[model samples]
Target: MVLPSVLNADFGDLGGELQRLTDAGARALHLDVMDGHFVPNLTFGMPIVEGLRRHTDLPLDVHLMISDPLRYAGPMVDAGADMLTFHVEAVDDPAAAAQSIADLGVAVGVAINPDASMDQLEPCLDHVDMVLIMSVQAGFGGQAFNPIALERLRSLRNQYPDLLLEADGGIKASNIADVRAAGCDCFVVGSAILKSDDYGKAIDELNDQIASANPSGANISPGQEATR
Candidate 1:
């Protein structure tokens, strides 16, 4: 499904922005948590997630781009995160990390950068509920779309038919069709929805593309949402 990334949303008016996305048919929200050490950027922490949890019912898909995801996983989950994703590049034992996160009673997710491969995630595939495939370099927004992500998503789908695969970065209506056709179960969109003049219209247009792209006409029907 379409997961509107909060990284591009107005920090001054996030509640209203979230309400607008919900009304626009977005089923979930993607929160990018970056630590300077891991991604050369630092964003808000649990307080923001706590505040957002009080403001909306939409599931919070928290992506932790931190050096130590295991350190922050529990706190994020306690802050009302429904799905938690961490970079494989950050930890040595993916299975142990995934198990720990899964034990917290939320959907466990694993993410890989554009340069990373599906083989890197094989160790934690069965432990994770979803997988986030970064199309652009992590730590920034508004980068150009990368087609290599489509190939990766397709590769993941081939290996695990039912695994929930997500694609983040540089995604928009123009290329969403190809992304969906490549087997992305969730699309983490930033500026395309946040920068639009009309949130509802932009989301509707994306849904239309997702609908028409797949011959099976399946919705982004995953057990949870995903992130950057």
Candidate 2:
């Protein structure tokens, strides 16, 4: 699935930008929620999330770049977040945070920084609905996609074949195919789409690249792994 990160979108015309993406056939919207304490940057809060909910019916993939996710789970869910992804390093107990989000009836995901190992998320893997491999450091957008993420994607795919794997950061038409090949099914594109004058066209280009790359592999789905 293609999820356009709103971090690079025109904040003043967010509704319009979201509508354009929806019109282009995006299934979900990616929101980067950064608190000053987690990373160097600070971004939107729960209020913005609540406000955005009114403008779009698409599922919100909320990535909390904060130090505390358990504290914000309720507010985020109340703000209409369909999925909540928290950093593995942020919480003392990843499994608990995953359960906490799941308990709130929202899809839970675990995100690992580029330098972090996939092993850090093993305990929560079974509980999460997805795993996001950050291609770059958190807190910033438009940075170059780090090649290290490809190996992480490969490892995750090899270990949990059916898990919903997503890639975020510096994704563009040039590297999207390679990313998908490495095992990312969901592409979280930001500046590439938001910075372009033609949002729909940009999305179309990304899809086209992914289609041409034709990622080939097999892995167990999350459901199958759980049963195993």
Candidate 3:
């Protein structure tokens, strides 16, 4: 699925970016909420998320890179987040945090930084609707993709065959195929699309590529080695 990362969007012209993504058939909007304490970079809060809620009808996939996700889960959900995803390393109780988000009647997701392992999220897998594998460090955007994170996503795809496997960070047309082959059904692309001169065209191209690779929209089975 196409999910445009809002972090790279033109904040000064937020509505324009949202409209561009929506017009280009983006399935969801990825909101990256970062707290300086957890990731060394501060980002938008509930007000922005709430304001964006009125801009588009696409599902708001909010990614929380903060210390205490539980504290903001309720407010985010109330502010119009359709799916809430938080870092596995941030929360004191990952499973509990996932449950709390799930209880808000929104889909719950758990994210793992490039250095985190699949085993770190094993206990909370069933409670989450999607598993986000960050292909770069959490704080900033436009960084190079970390190859190791691809393996982590491959592993999660093997263990939870039916769960949504999302990959974020350095996602562009160049690496979309490889990520898809690695079993990522959802993608959070930032600078790749937003920074392009033709934002709408970029999104259309990515969607076409994804569709061509998975015409049936079936999740490709992970490699045998990944299952272990």
Candidate with best TM-score: 1
On the 0 to 100 scale, the lDDT of residue 31 in model 2 is 93
Q: Is candidate 1 or candidate 2 better by TM-score?
A: 1
Better candidate number, 1 or 3, judged by TM-score: 1
List TM-score per model, in order: 0.94, 0.93, 0.92
* lDDT of residue 101 for candidate 2: 88
Query: How many clashes in each candidate?
Result: 0, 4, 0
lDDT (Cα, tens digit) per residue for candidate 2, span 46-123: 988999899877788899999999999899999988888999999999998899888988788899998877778989
194: Cα error in model 2, Å: 0.3
The local lDDT score (0 to 100) that residue 142 gets in candidate 3 is 93
Candidate 1 segments whose C-alpha is farther than 4 A from its true place: 215-228
* lDDT sort, best first: 1, 2, 3
lDDT by residue (1-228, candidate 1, tens digit) is 888999999989987887788888888889999989899888889999999999888788899999999998889988999988999999999999999998888888899998876688989998888888999989999999888898888998998998888899999999999999999888999999999999889988888898889755445433332222
- List the pairs of residues colliding in candidate 3: none
Residue 125 local lDDT, model 1: 92
Runs in model 2 deviating more than 4 A are: 215-228
Scored against the true structure, residue 31 in model 1 reaches a CA lDDT of 94
Candidate 1 pairs with clashing backbones: none
